[model samples]
Target: MLASRNRDTNSLLKSEKKSLLRFLALYTSLVILLITLLSIFYYQSQEKLMFSNQRAELSKYAYIQTKRLKVLHYFFPERTTYPRDPRFKSAIYDIEYKKIFSLLENENIHFNEEIYRAGNYIHFVKLLDTYYLGTKYLIIEVPEDMAWKKEAWKQIAIGSVLAFILFMVFGLILARLFLKPMRDSIVLLDRFIKDTTHELNTPLSAILTNIEMMDTDVMAEKNKKKLNRINIAAKTVSQLYKDLTYLTLKQEQKDHKEEIELQGLIRDRIEYFTALANTKQLYFELDTENVIIHADKQKITRVIDNLLSNAIKYNKRGGTISIKLRIGSLEVSDTGVGIDEEKIPFIFDRYMRFNQSEGGFGVGLSIVKKILDEYHIKIEVYSTINKGTKMVLTW
Candidate 1:
């Protein structure tokens, strides 16, 4: 049951994380897009203002030149004199929009009132109201002011980078705010499980101890059978209670490590499960060497108990369970209903049960895996449906 709870919590955490990431990604994208659009608008507005200022200056220059031409045209018609402005190049066009005279020869200039950029110059065209020497359009071309444009671009780049950094920080803050409730709920659930497991430990231990103390020799045959069933049921609950206690409170327990004889430990655990095995007429074949391991005795016992319990619980009637313990490895193989190929990968995952028909909380392998991992032991499992399963542990 604790394993099932853990699995549910893990699944919920994964779902919450995925949702948070998706929301953050979308929020960040929209924020970045808005910043980009604003940057573009600001840049274009600055460029337009610069261009407007350039056009105003060019208009004033053109007006001065036009005034000079008008004076020369009305007073001194045969002089062929033109206004000279050394700041920019000037051109004159007739009413037909054909260039009549220019400071620069063979230059292609568009005759329009709007300011335009061509090559390395800002071109401005204006139509004069009063004709001077048959001139109708006064066109002026000035060298572009690149320094101001470079500064504007630099500002835009800096602004964009700063905006991106600010939005990222805001997005992270928003994500944490959104996930706070889920985090609180998970914390509450963990606290509840810890408290509940703490409450169950005493009663479960009392029940198992009382059952173990009961004498079967003085009871009737019928009563003996009933006692055996009760014993079996109590042991099953005890195992589950142990798994939960280990998961919730094992860290609080004192560590006591010692050299344990593998053969002797296996024999003891198998003896404890013999009565349960006999209910299904299951037999055990032990082929073990006298190997000793240095580890916590209780933890190693839990590992062996879970493996032996699972083998008996899932074994077929009159089936055989083979146990092998060598120098660096221990293997438990059984001729019980085996797991499917697809379920093999997740066999050790919390709450994962292949044989639903069997009576168990499905936490046995999960506990086994945890204990093995703590001891730096590697476990390998091979199973085929309706055939058998072999669990091998290598230290």
Candidate 2:
């Protein structure tokens, strides 16, 4: 029964995993989008502020140049033709030559001109100061007239990359953190299933054995028949209990890949269940090959027992239970009430009952499946209702 639950749990987990991953991907994408938008906004704001400051400084310089021209045009009349102070010593279109001569002439005035030149610089002007007492013309340079906005672009690139990296780091860590509790819950559930199955084995065995020891013959004939059917019911529970234990602990038994005679194994298990078959008046049909299987003996025994007992329980009165152990296959064919086509695959699932009168927990074939899986074996079942059923196990 837990085996079926495990399969169902696995399916649920698989579905949940897909949803979690899709959600994580979507959240990560959203983080990236928000970060990109913020980076763009930050860079735009900084660009606007930087350009605004540049424009303010340029406007102040233009106003100073216009005022200086007005002063020079009014106060200096002999210099209306542009006075040549000894301070203005270079030829008319040479600011470099003028500054060089002025520096050699007077260190104090040259220092003041150099300070102003460093701030609102006009490179190709003719005078010591573009704001000098001039002949009524002014020269102005704006930082915006440059060919490239290199610094603004550099800041934008750096900010965008940093935002992208920051979001990636946070997204990965958050996704893992969010999924941790779910992973732990799944692990706890698996352990609980395994533990519960283990606890059931001892009591179920005692119940089956005590029922077998009951004195049914001394009772009314009808009561005797009812007791016998109860015994069958008990055995079916015992079968399911055994299968659950097998699926849980059978793996660590170190009982894989053994060379054993197939005929002897079949005979041994048949003899063990001979009493049960006798109660149901089912005849045994055995076909042997002296073959050897490299597999666990106990697990194979469980598979045989489940199949044989099922055939006996579901068979008609005095039905034939045929078992064949061939070279590459082991087949069990029963002259019992067969199965519907739709129920064949479902039989391997837990607690799936097609016939309520079968008196089983419906875990036998699931155990058969588990054992066969360990040995890399495959099984096929074909049946028609009330006719017969044949099961083939291929290795």
Candidate 3:
């Protein structure tokens, strides 16, 4: 069932891809969230430090002006001139919150220690003693320039991009690390199957060849029956070996496609399994036309052999198998303990056996399906429990 194996491999790969994407997406989201929060914190801290330094500079200027005013009040008591600084706009207010003198036209200001931003200026307010030329509040306004904030944001953006790249690289590494064990186990299992199949080939061929060469005519009737039983058993093992070899070494097999007479091939395969069928007293009704098909002979033989083998193996004692071959189709119907409707869909799956009591690896239908797929053949199955199964293959 190369097709089935390929499908399984593709399905597994898709599942792994989804898992990798999910892990990467979740990890990227978390990293982005952490980076965003840290950037916000760094930006706030930088802004706070910048404002604090500006406020200190403004407070120094206010102190200088206050000292100058006290000196001017003692020297020229009647003059309206007050000490001023050219670095920033300044204002003086009375105890009733009324402005006395200001370089700015607007007098709206609050008496608080913290800095405030209004319009395009950084505002700072402080309380003054009435002894400093009767001024009760001093306010300072500095022009606000956001160049430092823009630079800080640019740095944060660059840092976030670098962090995302680093996390993606590490996430891929982590995903590979997590999948390593599973890959190793699959490789180990594949090696075991290949080795086991290789080992089984020689002994199986030897047994089947020797049994075929045996002289059953010279033996007593009872002994002949025993020999027949041995032949049947050997053939059963031989079929299993063939299925295993096909699954393991299918890629190595060479295809030689040629026109084949379907009638003769079906008859030959049926004869091959005659001994096995006789074990259960099964009979066959062949209604085959002399149809010709262009396909690999060995693969077509395998398809027919597996189907006949399953029909015989699952058939009741003295059950009749009806085989029909027409222009572009082949039908095999058997009086067997049939498969359930639900299980019919999975009948072609490797190692899927509905009847566990039957002695088989459950790969017969899977092999048949693969061979048919190569020829672009379609198969339909119909069955009723405790009744029979009818398999129809149409080109």
Residue 29 in candidate 3, Cα distance off native in Å? 20
Quote model 1's TM-score.
0.56
Name the weakest run of 10 consecutive residues (lDDT summed) in model 1: 6-15
lDDT by residue for model 1 (33-62), tens: 898899889989988998989988998988
Model 2 residue runs over 4 Å out of place are: 1-200, 203-237, 251-255
Off by over 4 Å in 3: 1-190
Candidate 3 to truth, TM: 0.56
For every candidate, C-alpha RMSD to the true structure in Å? 7.9, 14.4, 9.6
TM-score of each: 0.56, 0.46, 0.56
lDDT of 2 by residue, 34-137 (tens): 86787678767865665566556545554554464556657766455432333122112233333211211222232223122223322112233453542222
lDDT of each: 0.82, 0.65, 0.81
Indicate the residue-level lDDT of 4 in model 3: 49
- The candidate with the higher TM-score, 2 or 3, is 3
Candidates sorted by lDDT, best first: 1, 3, 2
